[model samples]
Target: MISTAIHCGACGARMEPGANYCSNCATGRDDPNTRALFVVDGTTGLFNDAFTGALVDHETSRAMRYKRPISVLVAMLDHSEFIANDHGPAQSADLLRELAEVLAGAVRDIDTVGYLGDRFCMVLPETDQAGAMVAADKVMHAVAAHQYAAGHGQWERITLSLGLATVNPDRMGRQDLIQSATLALMDGRSDGSNKVHLVSQMS
Candidate 1:
């Protein structure tokens, strides 16, 4: 689907990926709302936490209004601490940016993906538990397929331990759903890496 994430200031045209100016009118985007709509990595550009949270809030409301399912996925790199300690924070942070890019490419433009605290989170609107699992699996596969610089010019593979939670809007709020997925991810990581764990509404 075409993403209506941001629009041109001059002509109200939709901004395309990797665009700094409007393709139709070449208008410069200085609008705060435009920045909020574009998701970027922390080190690279503007990463808006409030925007992600607000998107979740809107999605939750939409799900409730439509009686649909919404799923949240929380994922972290396996041995992340070790990577930071061994290779330094810069490398680890770079990997995270790469992870975010991979995740951005893996899902639809409508989906929200960004750093929620230290871990990465994806909010999938109208996605049920099954769809969330599939997305999580795709992420794991994407991580496996991409190689990262391990420092000293050596490249290595990394894995993700992901947690997925799905619920109808009537069951939980945005934060609650994210927390459920995060807790599930913690549990799954304890068992093994490169795995996707699923959870439903709390209690």
Candidate 2:
């Protein structure tokens, strides 16, 4: 009989054994085989230069090593499209960072946000599809009302393409998890902008 004793990362309290997750703080059971949820694959020098480097270190060293199932939120800023059409890059970049920071504040400290290629990856630990949706909404809302202060001589607004997906180690591996979420993002973006589409996978 494998007794899985769940424990909260925030506070050392014995969680209800075999619980879906830690009810108190949503800490998931420690399993060495669950897939990762977050996938941010973006180009360099968009959000921050250190984003991708930091992401790789964290994923390989901490996330993958622990075997915790991951949930991912990807935010892609189409600056090139805007620039080609004679739009402001500075204003757009600022808005993107603001949205990313908002998402960072919304998740638990244990969770991580990293750069994957040109996109930003939000690693949600033990969070399900529903919870990820709520978190994504928080970011969307935060970005929506964020004014770029027109009087400050700024273009003052930017659009984003976002997607959400969860990684279940019991079902997927590293490459597959990334592929699943990436496909979802593409599908969502194909539909329209400013959308948060949930991946068709178990959260």
Candidate 3:
């Protein structure tokens, strides 16, 4: 029996696990359409408050609520830089699919993948920042190993940058989660290639 409670994102009211409706706003407990926000810069997407909310909703509905803190990892693939001098989206379908496969292999069956524009998001349920880093390292290694199909009948090896941050109900909302990840990703891109940035962790 869980005793902790979270606030209704739509309305500032306390909500407990198994809550199907917001007592203050009368909003449906789990709104699937209220999705997580992603700031995609090329192939990178930052998970924010919207994403956290959705996870909370889904987990509560299914009765598999996450008791431990969790984090979000955002990775983007730059189109122009992906094929160096080719001004287009990354078109290495085989390589991208392979990378995704490799990453999926590393995660638990409960975790899920989402398409946020050109970027992809991996929802790490019940995972903390450190655990996410391990998964990110696996993904980075797998992606770095790929020989992507560059434009104009050429092959190229690409790189990736990642941002990681944990979800905190008190200190953040859905949008804040996205913002933290985005800021971390931007900082990483500025720092150098093939780096993972850990922005925040539950205290």
Candidate 4:
């Protein structure tokens, strides 16, 4: 597949029935093979950017309509450049794949985890700011507890930083939520990696 976007009408993230994509994705909308390739990141088996964005937007709209809390978290593997430099770009990608599994395991089943191009994003439904922090801690601890095989049977522990944003119906939209999470991620990274930041903490 050439990696072109194919969004579905039902949810905007295109997929076919029984495909290895998100639950709402496989709405029997697009060709199975094409949908799978378009929606999934081949390396990590997570939703690709186009599909993830749709999921985010969908969740945001739902949260807004129902007056329920929803949180979005943006995370990045700390010192990824160092990992790439020390090992190779492939190794860095492998580490990311491993991290993706950890993230999948750490969050609730209802939560959606995806690769948003350069970073991993988690969309948490019914999760407010406090719940988001708890989820982030689970992810951080889960990652810290696991070790990745760097090379030559060498096990290396990896870490990450997370930024969180909860939808504020009064003032926040999808873009605002994403930007807040990105800013929070930046704040945590600036203070030194392995931290979780919130937009409210921004000085």
| TM-score for predicted model 1 compared with the true structure | 0.75
What clash count does candidate 2 reach?
16
lDDT of 1 by residue, 1-203 (tens): 98559877766767756667543333457752444334444663324455556556666776877878888888888887777777787776676776677777887755767676578888888887778788888888988887665433443777888888887645654456777888888876778888998874443
TM-score per candidate, in order?
0.75, 0.56, 0.57, 0.79
lDDT of each: 0.70, 0.55, 0.56, 0.76
Ranking by lDDT: 4, 1, 3, 2
Best by TM-score: 4
Stretches off by above 4 angstroms in model 3 are 1-66, 78-98, 149-155, 168-175, 200-203
Q: Tell me the lDDT of candidate 2.
A: 0.55
Q: Model 4, residue 85: displacement in angstroms?
A: 0.5
RMSD to native, candidate 1: 6.4
Give candidate 3's whole-model lDDT: 0.56
- Candidate that beats the other on lDDT, 2 or 4, i.e. the better one: 4
Q: What are the clash counts of all predictions, listed in order?
A: 0, 16, 11, 0
How would you order the candidates by TM-score, starting with the best?
A: 4, 1, 3, 2
Give the higher-lDDT candidate: 1 or 2.
1
**For this target, which candidate reaches the highest lDDT against the unseen true structure?**
4
Model 3 lDDT at residue 112: 51
- Model 1 misplaced regions, further than 4 Å: 1-41, 44-46, 150-155, 169-175, 200-203
Question: Using alpha carbons, what is the TM-score of model 2?
Answer: 0.56
- How far off is residue 165 in model 4, in Å? 0.5
